[model samples]
Target: MTKLNCPFCYNTIRRRSELHFMCRGRPTGARPACQPELDQVRSNLTGFKEATLPTFEAVSENLMLPFTKAHCPKCGGETTTRACSHCHTRLPMEFGLDASPMVAMVGARGTGKTVYLTVLSNELQKPKIRSEFAATVRPIGEGQDGFGAQDQWVRESIHQVYEDRKLFSTTAQAVDGRKAPIVLEWRGRHNRRFVLRKFRTNYLSFYDTAGEDLTADDVTFKLHYLRAADYLILLLDPFQLPEVQRLLRLPPAALLHVREGKPPIDVLARVTEALKQGDHWNGRHITVPVAVAFAKMDAFNQHLPETHPLRARRRTLGGYDEKTGRIIHEEMKSLLHEWGGDEIDAHLSGHYRSYQYFAVSALGAEPDYENYLVNPRGVRPDRVEEPLLWLMHKGGLVPRAAS
Candidate 1:
């Protein structure tokens, strides 16, 4: 029994000890179907108003070993469906049995966090990447092999980014019900020679908060998930770099996308402070691994030398490459120094015990900002999944490259 924070509500709980379940709703002559009710706890946390299947705690005899399947208190029907104790969102059947790593994504406004998240999720579903990583990124809501998630938050995101070939609207603030963490099941095959092939399934909970939500100290501190996160994806806007912004000249329309906010280092400091606000951290350097990525690389890649490490593809194969990972880490660190963002590298080094730098472009090419459409070349994603792949490698969800 391991303890984990519920991805939806961000509350810590022992997996088996705090179990709650939902009714399957199969009506029988003996027991009628359960009625839907307004779950206030769920409505408050998720902003979902619609009444749903009744959820109840399982009554069991043994405290050491809890019941996996029990007769529903409401319907008298046997059900195994699990729900989070705090938020009541449906948990996957495999959730309590496996490791569900929380990856908290945060950055300032105008960093293109939504676009990057959309493209990254779309890229991870491609066959080439799937074959290489020996895994599939499936939405937790879908809970099936064929159709996509029933949650419109994801359906609409995919439609806007992949189907319509346009950038999706900015992610709504944390209070907005339309925004939810794109919870996923990273199911994979752990193949090893001279051994049994194991089913290695892991959960990935990515909550992409609105940039404005993290700008103020009070608001950022209230987001306790930052402290509970197993990993952090800190996205930085390239245009915010004074040196980089002045060096590149863009059309008037594209300029509309840039907006001023706290500096990148200042944003990192706020997040680091939030992580320290926890009981255990005490303002000391935290051990959580961070993947600090500069999103929208298209703005910089075109002007930099073609051979620059950031512009070149570092990951083209299946497993994680430690050698290339380090190379790019250093390359991006130096590039930051050149862009007058050395304080960012220093701040990360001082605050986080482990951190890596990456350059990712959700759209491989810059979009037509005025028309709200992708480039004429379409949304060709460049290394959008590299940060996640590296994080996966760190978690042992994927293998280390063999020489």
Candidate 2:
């Protein structure tokens, strides 16, 4: 009886005894769109005209009865798929029956969020990792004829980072020009039980926007999808830490060259304001788990002691080590304080009731720029999946154990 959230519109669908259906094909005539909200979503994803939108009609007349399929009332054509009752968008095969976790990745510019996402996707698709987790992750709406803009962007991004070993360009800053959010479907069974009960599917949607868009004053209205996220991963760039920049002798030119957008504190404040507006935190701590991770840790790995928890690499994947996660969390918090990021630490602690810290390096080593291309030594990610694994464990989707 779990509640399902529409990946496109972020509308919550309550559990019901009977199933509902919506037409999959576009309306033949000018019957008028039944769901204007869904039409807006379609228009945002694709440049389709609202007047030529598909219409939805409920197939079942009784709430306690089951309907295998239905016909579009407008065209009299049969439909074999199901859709969200609130929004007419087609639902995944068994969407309403399983759990779907919406994850949002947010950070200031040059925080390595895009690189982290690219590497994380590659890591999740690895044979050994998928075998250990007993899951298969793939992008949604990829094969569909109508919706392909967002899917194409994801494919290009992954190919660039994993195949070509090159970095992606800066995210588009204009709200209207930005691509749609990347949505993925993770289908697998639980690792705890041996006997087969029923296979479960979880939909994971990611929203990656330009760092400038997040810092804008009108972000609350622009990025309304943040309100529907089940988990938040806030990436903090090591180069932005004033103490780290000074200790490493990183020149002003280097900082300016990388387009260091805004301080992490300011970006986080803007995110907090948006969350408050959504009633996520009403003068109280928010329930959504936040992972405050230090991206580009490879650049600063030399500064840490040999015995530092972050220096160790994770080997197994069936379950997370709670004790080890806590150790790293505390170590990262201490490092932030020493790096003159105590204000950022304080802000997170005050607003989020449940939060943890992590350190990750997407490239495993700093890339050398030559002839306008980077990563001459090739790319090897180090512990890039740790944050995702931690979130899965916290949500009880994966097991947790002490090291």
Candidate 3:
């Protein structure tokens, strides 16, 4: 049996042994273990009180037993759904039975993670792209038939970016205890030996938190989700790099908007430390594939020559091209050195067993700021889907061509 990670709380559930049940009545008004501390933090960050959260009780049951149902101990109501043994969040129907890839997005504040996620979801759901991979992207559980609150947020974020051509507001730093993860189910045919034979379904869980929450040194408990990720996407904002900011020669007004938090290297260090505290390697390098991407590539194009590898575009709907990806990786490495990010490069190399450099531009052009909205020319994403496709290829979800 596979040990599944909870998409909501980032808890690992050992399917064979531990099974947790939640009240079907959806009991409310009870507080979680860390509610008081979390509430204080949320209030300080967003200046608002979090709503009361539901309480979930753990149920110990033997799967080998013949019991067909469970009942909540407190409310005595019939419990029909399973939850994460650790966080008590509801689990999807196929949570333990199928392969689920937990992809975590990490970066300093103002790194465009929200935009990347919005575009990545849009690209994955495109019919042509889905046809190329023989995959269909759908919501799971509460989001299966209709949009849950989190699903609605994702849909609205995507619509605002793609249809309305407006930039999403920076994700708030406060943590909402009631927030559920946006879980997507990917069903596709696995092509093997030039034939589509096995049908595979994977649950893709995305956790998008405010960048400040990730870099908070005083609060590490809330960021435990980083350790449970199967893959990590470290988005390095070019604009955040001090050297790049100087080189870009932006106007003073643009510089004023740039809020520099912890450096990318520092953020990566904290993530690696979190992994060490968990079951992730002890005194060993992390084996999970880490895709360190340079986001907002369009802003840096002026510095690169016309023949730069980053300027080369590939078909977004086709299978991943390792040759092209490698070229971009090398080019990005060189650019990182030029941008005085050698420490970031060195830290990744020393801590991760498998790492790749990528450059992606979610918006093809810079946005025109109008009040709180940023209107771009059009949604012409450059290589926004490559990092995800690369992760899928590395995980063996898609067949890799012979080297």
Assess every candidate by TM-score.
Answer: 0.91, 0.86, 0.79
What C-alpha lDDT, on a 0 to 100 scale, does residue 275 get in candidate 2? 84
| Alpha-carbon lDDT, every model | 0.75, 0.71, 0.69
- Order of candidates by TM-score, top first? 1, 2, 3
Segments of candidate 2 deviating more than 4 angstroms: 15-41, 44-55, 61-65, 85-87, 174-179, 191-197, 251-254, 257-260, 305-307, 313-316, 369-372
lDDT of 1 by residue, 10-90 (tens): 677675547688877878668788877778988787665667777788678456765787677767877788888887877
**Candidate 3 residue lDDT tens string, 116-145:** 888888777788767777788766653442
lDDT of 3 at 369: 40
Strongest candidate by lDDT: 1
User: How close to the true structure is residue 138 of candidate 1, measured as C-alpha lDDT?
Assistant: 67
Model 3, runs deviating above 4 Å: 16-82, 86-88, 142-147, 174-179, 190-198, 252-260, 313-318, 369-376, 401-403
Estimate, for each residue in 1-403, the C-alpha lDDT of model 2 and write its tens digit.
5556776556677763233455555454656424333366455543333332254555464557565566677555556566655545556666765678878889988677888887777677778667876788777766873346556777887788767777766777645523456677777785546636567777777777678787677754567668878889988887887798888776454466245488889889988888877757757988788888898788876777666667864535466777777888988899889999999889998899989999888888776423223466777788777787788788877777545
What order do candidates take by lDDT, descending?
1, 2, 3
Task: Determine which window of 10 residues in candidate 2 has minimal summed lDDT.
Answer: 46-55
Model 3 alpha-carbon miss at residue 65, Å:
11
- Give the top-scoring candidate (TM-score): 1
Task: Quote the positional error of residue 60 for candidate 2 in Å.
Answer: 1.3
